[model samples]
Target: MHIITRCEEMKIWSLRKNKTPMLHYFLFAYWFILLVWQNLGAGGSANRGGMDVVIKCGLLVMLMIYYFMHATGIRRDILLMCMLLVGVYAIVKIEGGLDLSKILYYFFPFLFVLLIFGVGWKFELNKRQLVHLCNMLIVVVSYIAVYALIFCTDQFANAFSIDNAYGNELKSFLMSSHEYGMYLVFGIMAIILCMEFDPEGTKNRRFWYFLALILFSVNLILTFSRTSILSLAVLLIFYVLIFAKKRLRNWFLILAGIAVLMVLVIPSLRNFFWEIVMKENNDAGRDALIDFGMAFYRDGSVSQKLFGWDYAPIKAYLASSRGLGSFHNAYVQQIVANGLLGVFIMIMYSVVTLYDIFRTIKTKKEGSHLSKFFISFAASAVVFMTFNTAALFASAIDSYFMTLFTVVVPKYVNQSIRAGTFDVPIKNRETRPNVRRVYR
Candidate 1:
C-alpha cells in the first residue's frame, strides 16, 4: 500500500475523472448553511416544512452516492447497531399508534446519524480545506453575531428585563441564549484549532484569528448561559493544560486571574453571577422534570419500559399539566422516548467515541492537530450533552457539526496511525516550520 500525504491525496483527487471532491465541497457548504440558519423562522422555530424536506432528501442522496463511490471501508458493527436501534424505535412508534408523519419525524435523527457517520467515515479533507471550512463558519457566525448586536440587542435587553431588572442576556438568532452560546462555543473551538493547526502564516492571519476569538468570547459571555460558560471555561483549561505553549499558558493564567478579579470587584458582575448560580432555581426545575420522567417510567408497563411509549404519548404527556414540555436532559429524554434500550445505544456510542479519542491522544504524538481538535470537540460534546438534548440525535446545526467531527477525527486518527505518521513525537520531528502536515 502506498501512503500519501494530504496534499498529494488532494492533488490526486482533484485530477480524478469523478467530481467527488467538488461534491464534498458542495456538501460542506450545504452543511454550513444548515448550521447557520438552523432557526430561521418566527420565534426561533425551524422551518421544517418547505425546503427542509428538499435539503434533507438531497443530503441523503448525495451521502449515499459519496459513500458508495469513495468509502474504502465501512464499520459494519457500528452500522448494524445503528440500524437495529432505529428499527426498534420505528417498531415501538408503530405499536404506540403514532402517525406516519410523526414517526417519520422521529426517523430524522436516525437518518441524520447515519448520514453523519457515513460522511465522517468516508469523506476526507486536508488541513487547508478544514481551515477554509472553519473560516467560512467563523465568517457566517460572526455576521450573525454582529447582526444580533446591532438589531437584536434592544430586544434581548427588553426580554431579559421582563425577567429581572438587571438581566441582559443575548440570544441572537437562535432559539435560546443557550443555543447561541453553543454556536459560539463551536466557533471558538474552530478558531482556536485552525490557529494551532495552521499557524505558519502572516501576522494578519494571527490578528484575524485573535479578533475572531475575542468576538466569539464576548458573544458567549453575553449569552449568559451557565452551561456554555462552564463549557468554554473547561475547553480553555483543557487546551491550556494539554496543548498550549508555556507563554500562552502564562497569558491564560493572567487572563483568568483578571476575570476572577472583575467578578469579585464589579457589582453588576457579582449580581449576574448570583442570578445565574442562585436566583435562577434551574436545578429545582431540572430535578422536578427528572423526577417526573422517572416516575412516568416507573408507572409504565413492561413493554413500555422496554421499548418506550413512542412520540405521540410522550408529546401528549408533555402537553399535559404535569409535564414540562421537555425532559430537560438528553439521557432522560432518550429513556422516555426509547426506554432503556435507547439509552444503552446512546451510551454505547458515546463510550466508543470517547475511547477512540483517548486512544488517539495516547498513541498520537503530543501537539498532533487531529488529536487536539478531537479533544476539544469531545469536551464540547460532553458538555453539550450534559445540558441539552438536541445536539447528538437531532438534525439541527449543532448536530451537523457534532456528527461531522465525531466521524472525521477518528477516521483521520486511524489513517495517521496506519501510516506510522502519528508514532513520532512532536519534539522528535524535523519538519519544515512553514508546512502543515495532516491526514486527508
Candidate 2:
C-alpha cells in the first residue's frame, strides 16, 4: 500500500476502536492556538493571525457540529434553540450583527458551550475512549505549559503598543500583552496537568508534571496578570490541600520549592507574590476602576445604568470622563448591559453549575482530588472576575478557563476513567464477615 493508504488504514483502525481522533486533535489544536495567541497576538499570517476571531468562530462551529451529531432528544434540542435565541437577542441588542469584539469574542462562547454541552455533553464524555482523549489533551496542555515557560517572549507587549515600562516588566514572563487573557487559560491548563499527573500515583509522570507547574508558576508571575496569578494561587492551594495524597509532605515540598525559587532565581517575585496577597499600588488602580465602574451604576441615566453603558458606551463615557471610561469589572459590565436580569441569569447559572459539580464530586467515588481541582479551577475563575472584568466575556481568557474547567475537564476525566473500565471497588459483604453485624 502507498504511505497515504497505510496512514488511512491506521486512522480507520483507531476510529473503529472508538477512539476519537478528531476531538483529541481539536483539543491539541486549541491548546496550540492558545499558545500562539498568547505569544503571537492577533496579527500575522492568516492562519495564526486573527486567532481570537478564529477561536470564537471555530468554537461556535465545532460546538454546533457536535450538537447536531450528538443531540439526544427533544429536550436538548429545545434548550439549545432557546439558548441560541437568547444569544441572538443579546447579540442584536449588544451589536446587531457581530461587529463588536464584545459580541463575537466575548458572548458567543458561553452561548455555544451552553447550547452544545449544557443539556448532556457531560454524559457524552463518559466513554473510556473519550477519557483517553482527555488524557491526550492533558499531555498536550502540559507540553504547552512547559513551552510557554521556556520560549515565550515579549511579543505580546509590542503587539498592543502598551507602555514600554509596563511591557519591560511584564513581557519577560508573558507570551503576548495583547492576549494576556489567554494566560489565564494557560493557568487553568496547568491545574489540570497537575491533577492528572500526580506524583506518587502517576510515578515517573510526576516529574514532568511538577516541572510543568513550576514553569506555569514562573510564567504567571512573569506575566504579571493579577487575575491569572490569583486564580492559580487559589487553585494550587485547593489542589494541594484537598487532593494531594500524603498531603502534608506534598504541600510542604511544593511550598518550599516555591519559596526557594523566589529566593534564588528571582527575588523580585517575592514582592510580586506578596503584592498579590496584599493588593498593593497597582492593585489599587484596579480597585479604582471598580469604583468608577460602580459610579456608572450609581450615577448614569436609568437606561445607561440599568441596561449597561455597553463597551462602546464606556469608551464614549470615558472619552468624556477625564478622557476615559471603562467598565473594568466583568460582572458590573453584565449588569450594565443586560440589566439585573442578565446578571441574575448569569449568577443563577453559575450557582447551579457549582452545586451540581460539588454534588457530583461528593457522590462519585473515583478521583476526588481531580474533581476538587476541576471545581477549584472553575470556582477560582468565577472569583477571579471580581478583580478583573473578563470572566464573563467571550474574548477574555477567563470565560475560556471557566468553560474548559466546568465543561471540558470534568467530562473528559469522568468519561476517560469510566471508559477505562476501572471499577470503583465496592466492598463485598461476603468478604467481610462482620460487615452485616457492624451495619446491623
Best by lDDT: 1
What's the lDDT of the predicted structure labeled candidate 1? Answer: 0.63
Query: Per-residue lDDT tens digits of candidate 2, residues 320-429?
Result: 86443445566876766556655765675567556555665765655533556566656576656665555442444445545555556566555444433223221211
Q: Give the TM-score comparing model 2 with the true structure, all chains together.
A: 0.67
> Local error of candidate 2 at 193, Å?
4.7
Best-performing candidate as measured by TM-score: 1
Candidate 1: C-alpha RMSD after superposition: 7.1
Writing each residue's lDDT as its tens digit, candidate 1 over 24-73 gives: 36556556656544566322444465465556556556656665565443
After superposition, the stretches of candidate 1 with alpha carbons farther than 4 Å from their true spots are 1-27, 35-38, 41-54, 97-105, 109-123, 155-168, 276-281, 320-324, 365-369, 406-440
- The global Cα lDDT (0 to 1) of model 2 is 0.51
Show the lowest summed lDDT stretch of 10 residues, model 1: 10-19
C-alpha lDDT of all candidate models, in order: 0.63, 0.51
Clashes of 2: 15
* Positional deviation of residue 143's Cα in model 2 after best superposition, in angstroms: 6.6
